[model samples]
Target: MNEVKLIDMLSYLEPELLEDDYIEKDMNKLKNLISKISESSSLITFNKGLRSIIKIITFIIASLLVLVGIIVIIIKKKKPKITKKAFNFVTN
Candidate 1:
């Protein structure tokens, strides 16, 4: 084929080679997509961190509540079975 026809055929197959506008648009679209992906990943990291912190706080609160309940139960009860043994031991 002639050089002119070969060039035309190649250009028709690859339109971006013939137009600056298409190249610019393609670059802009790629940049925007990259930025969106970066932002979404950052958001995911933040959400995971927040969820981890919340889980740790919830576990701590549950443990403290259980400890408090056990203490209260032990302190609030009165038993009468130990007085005689205590008096005999003290007298001996």
Candidate 2:
């Protein structure tokens, strides 16, 4: 019996194994795997986008702060210094 089964099995060994019925049986598993991968990829993309926006916003804010600091320094330097006596006299 074993010899007969082996001989029968060997007869169809050269054919391709990817038939429609085999795929249909595992369709649910394949769909679940695809959905999981798609969700993960979307999450990765969202994270990257969020990071990029945050970096851009940080750079802009830093640039604005530097510009404001430089402007403040320039204005302070342009202003004349008053003596302590003058300050006291003005206050009094």
RMSD of 2: 6.7
What is the C-alpha lDDT profile of model 2 across 1-92, one tens digit per residue?
69999989888776565344776768988999999999999999999999999999999999999999999998777655545557878999
Candidate 1 residue-wise lDDT, 1-92, digit = tens: 89999978776676555666877899999999999999999999999999999999999999999999998777555333356668888999
Against the reference, the lDDT scores of all candidates come to: 0.85, 0.86
Clashes of 2: 0
Q: What overall lDDT, based on C-alpha atoms, would model 1 receive against the true structure?
A: 0.85
Worst 10 residues of 1 by lDDT: 75-84
Highest-scoring model, TM-score: 2
Model 1, residue 57: C-alpha shift (Å): 0.9
TM-score attained by model 1: 0.62
Error of 2 at 62 (Å): 0.4
In candidate 2, what residue range of length 10 has the lowest lDDT sum? 14-23
Q: Which stretches of candidate 2 lie over 4 Å from their true place?
A: 1-25, 81-92
